[model samples]
Target: MAAPFLYSAWVAASMVLVPFAALTETRKLRRAGVSVARAHEKLGHATEPRPSAGPLVWFHAASVGESLSVLALIGRMGQALPQAHFLITSGTATSARLVASRLPPRTVHQFAPFDAPGPLNRFLNHWRPDAAIFVESEIWPQMLRRTHARGAKMALLNARLSARSIAGWQKRPKLARYLFEVFDLILTQNDQMAEAMVAMHAPPDRVARGINLKSMSDPLPVDEDALFEARAALSHRPVWIASSTHEGEEQTVLAAHHRLLKTHPDLHLILAPRHPERGDAVMRLIDTAGLSATRRTRGEHPGAQVYLADTMGELGTWYALGDIVFLGGSLRPIGGHNPFEVAQSGAIALSGPHVTNFDETYDAMVEAGAARIVKDSQDLAATVDSLLNDTDARDTARAAARSFTESQTDQLDTIAERLIKALELAP
Candidate 1:
């Protein structure tokens, strides 16, 4: 089918803005100290060479969560197609950093090109990917149309769209259908999303419900040396983690910790904010709460009532020290972080009710006794206190968490096989 007029208009607009977008993105990367050549990747300049042989499968995601969610799937696919090469692209420095450490074997990471004809053409021509998989809601109209035109098989994985987004697409049915038809398959995060995609005019035959890719992510890498050091510093004090805490939510968590301290005097709280750059601000909050705290980046021990784990890439180690974890983001209508990591670490997840992002995963966990929902500080404190004091209950919850995580892994194989078949990726 020919490109719709709206699609053509979008491409024309993007083409006109290409130079400005490239200059802006490159400058941002340079300000962050990225090398000139690497920073120019936004202009479709690749820092790495394409694989010489074997089918190259490309995966593109928007940012950190979306980027990391597909690593395990790549690993599974790698095992199935040992001779295949994989490439993943995202637009954030943080995602690039994290992905660098956990990249699957035979996989390469790249900064995605700006979505315009010039950049897209350079990217697609250089990589020459046999298949493309787009994660979450990263729908670049030009990228989709261009890649599909090149005859690469495409699938939209872990797809999701908000009600408002669906309504917007419904308004432009021709362009929506044209874009959605570029994908050979559309695997949504749930049936509701599948229905929404179809309502937005994605072919019903191509859309199906799939597992939440975030929930099936590879377990966070644990630093054993740091884990040992933290364990020694704590001397087995009763501990709980409040990880990925956002701005407004910390007050509630601090209040909960204060209440818990009255009962368990030696209890420790590991507070890891979502943005580690907010370390100083978080410390001020801790001081105002009248709680003595130690900072992780300062190399201080967890001897104080609160351990400010204000660093990136150490969450697995913190989760190892506790059986109870209060996942943040949920407490303040921020959609919540992944609880699969908590489950992988053999801990029960606790959160406030606002976990719409991972609603299906949380619902299953709550049903299986692997997770709990708290309303506020009182509820959080009471839940933590009970779990800490009741060994049998904590043990059951931990076991349930492990069981839930294990159960999710089986579906990974199914999803991988489906993608392989749909994308014709088998060697």
Candidate 2:
């Protein structure tokens, strides 16, 4: 039987509940340090000047990772369609900060408006984007409906659908069809995702198999002075990064580091928690491990056994310094953060077994000899030990990673070309 609370009912309820929802979300944003003056942007009022008299394409991403994944795509699309201006919108303060710092010329970043009818209408009317591209799985019902009504061509780029989400949408078949069919094109990260979208009744012709855009992301920028200082402080010690670690995963990383230290006493760890705000708690974990540490957010250099990289936007710097990268989130049930980002950094990437989130990407890398998987802390330490001692094997893994990542660049060009055709066909 279909779910009792169908999409129509949810839409009706949303039409009435939007005000309370907006207020609650606005409060959270304020607490997260979003500027009060510019908060109106989230309410569908523009604080920045809109680009005029061109084929303006609007790209929407949920947060920092998604926002950054599209940077290279936007740059490619900008070059391919020189007449087009780009508007990038994300829903977080951190994403806004990153976008502002990294966005290309002639591109604008705005906090995405809430999916309420009022704000979305206000946003659409003011900007009147010719085409809209949404990153990953952000299929906001009201936003999708409003954008479709406004005659903007739409595409779901690097689309992913988990088994749970597919099951939920299957409960509302018509609603699923309505949402999926609205997009002029749907580009998926893998054949598995493409097949899932087809099962949800997304048009087969419109669904194109493609790679994860995160694989094609521009290398994270590094602060040269910071890298220099980090090198000087470490003085050529062996290093590895626990990149994008979550709550329970930090303890695992700490345990692995503790074990690795006993064998390779000069080994260093850069623990970058997934959420920088968790820095304090992570520091406490490090202390419990009886390890000396430095917190990067406090402006300390990495001269200790563990460096807690509690700051944001510096993954590239650490990646450049690390000999191996063990991606976090996989250690816990949070799936996994992007390993391609690690591979793109030219580091030998390793992860735990629970990486269902990027299953295809990870499987491909492992098959290509670009990544390795560890089942537990002992395995992690053992693998890291082997990699560190075997210089030739380590170089082979890093080279394989770079080669696989570079080979996928042409996929971006294919996506950009298809997107341009979609834009031309827009009403």
Candidate 3:
């Protein structure tokens, strides 16, 4: 019912790219994982498959945030189904690296097959998963249809549908109807998203939206020795961190840093880009801002300048190093990255006003006064400087951050239970 309409709108929904195969294939080959570029790469070569006939659960997380949101469930699933093989797929290169960084034992990571029919069919033929789970709002017409046809129990966990996305889905209602019908259970991020999915043709009675996974603590792992070394070198310098920044937002951090240094002479700032490939460009932007900063890829200390926390999977260390933190992509129009990650690490969380991507989480944080909102660059600098100088204020912010993040971290658990029932598995 929902298949062909979605299949046709793959283009209209801006879902499929006509030139992606040609553009991405060569880039995937040319780029190396350790390099500054290729940060968005999600999967590796699916050229060969090792056959497995056991009960295999397939978890699909669209990118870095969506991918991380499923971690708790993945860990719990492993405990519940220790005998079952687990296969997880994330859609971006950075996500692949992050998943590879800390996935629990027994889980294997793969790049999601492109939405094209041929690759998806090939993947289905080989993996033969017993269950398929979607972390968020990833709808592939062919993938859903064929996976159901393969006798796999399909569920959407921690799903969300915003007003903006709803409008677009309505534009292609025929396609959306097909996509919506394919799921046996749709576990949403919030009540609003669940209501929206209902309007979009998801099974109303089966729809459950309650747990918000982004509010979970950051699984950012830090090396104790490395932490000691960085801290020893940093030495009482008031610190702040900017994690997962987008374009045009770098200058804001730099501008804030310049103002912050005036009052707190030893104020140190760290920049962790959303894309690792853009490390050099961010370094250049920092340099152009007339601030002396060192790239972490080099062994240089922050030293009265900024430190580019340009390395991947090291947000744990950076978050630990900073007292005040800003989760970027919010200050600009880019749907802000996860604020929950920093909050769990005990950093004071702040953002710019444009956090439409995680509005519910952001609003909750604001209502709790766990996060500070900076509407523009000037407010950004002022807010950061104030947080840095005032210990009580910083502590208040970090407390708010932890409270909001801790409160919303259990969606994965709820989804896990529903998934078991949907699969008709024994309790």
Worst 10 residues of 1 by lDDT: 31-40
**Per-residue C-alpha lDDT of model 1 across residues 1-427, encoded as one tens digit per residue:** 7789988988889988998888898888777667888777787888899999899999999999999999999999999999899999999888888999999999999999998989999898899999999998999999999999999999999998777888999999999989999999999999889999999999999999998999999989889999888899889699999999999888899999999999999999999999998999999999999999999899887889999999888898899898899999987778998988899999999999999899999999999999999999999999999998899999999999999999998899999999999999886
Model 3 clash pairs are 2-178, 5-175, 6-175, 36-277, 40-93, 41-92, 41-93, 42-92, 42-93, 43-111
Error at 68, model 1, angstroms: 0.7
**Model 3, range 349-375, lDDT digits (tens) per residue?**
789888876777778777887777888
Please list the C-alpha lDDT of all candidates, in the order they appear. Answer: 0.93, 0.87, 0.74
- Model 2: per-residue Cα lDDT over 1-427, one tens digit each: 1323455676677778878877877787788788785677887888877776678899999998899999999999888777778999998888988888899867999889887778888999899888999999999987887798889999999998778999888777778887887799999988889999998888888998877887788888989999999999999799999989888888888888899988899999999998999999999999998999998988899989999999889898999998699999898788887888888888988999989778888988999889999988889999999998999999999999999888888888888888888767322
| True-structure lDDT of candidate 2 | 0.87
User: Which scores better on lDDT, 2 or 3?
Assistant: 2
Give candidate 2's root-mean-square deviation (CA, Å): 2.6
Candidate 1, 39: how far from true, in Å?
1.6
Off by over 4 Å in 3: 1-23, 33-54, 161-165, 409-411
After superposing candidate 1 on the true structure, give the runs of residues whose Cα lies further than 4 Å from its correct spot: none
lDDT, model 1, position 193: 94
Which is better, 1 or 3, measured by TM-score?
Answer: 1
User: By TM-score, how accurate is candidate 2?
Assistant: 0.95
Sequence-dependent TM-score of model 3:
0.87
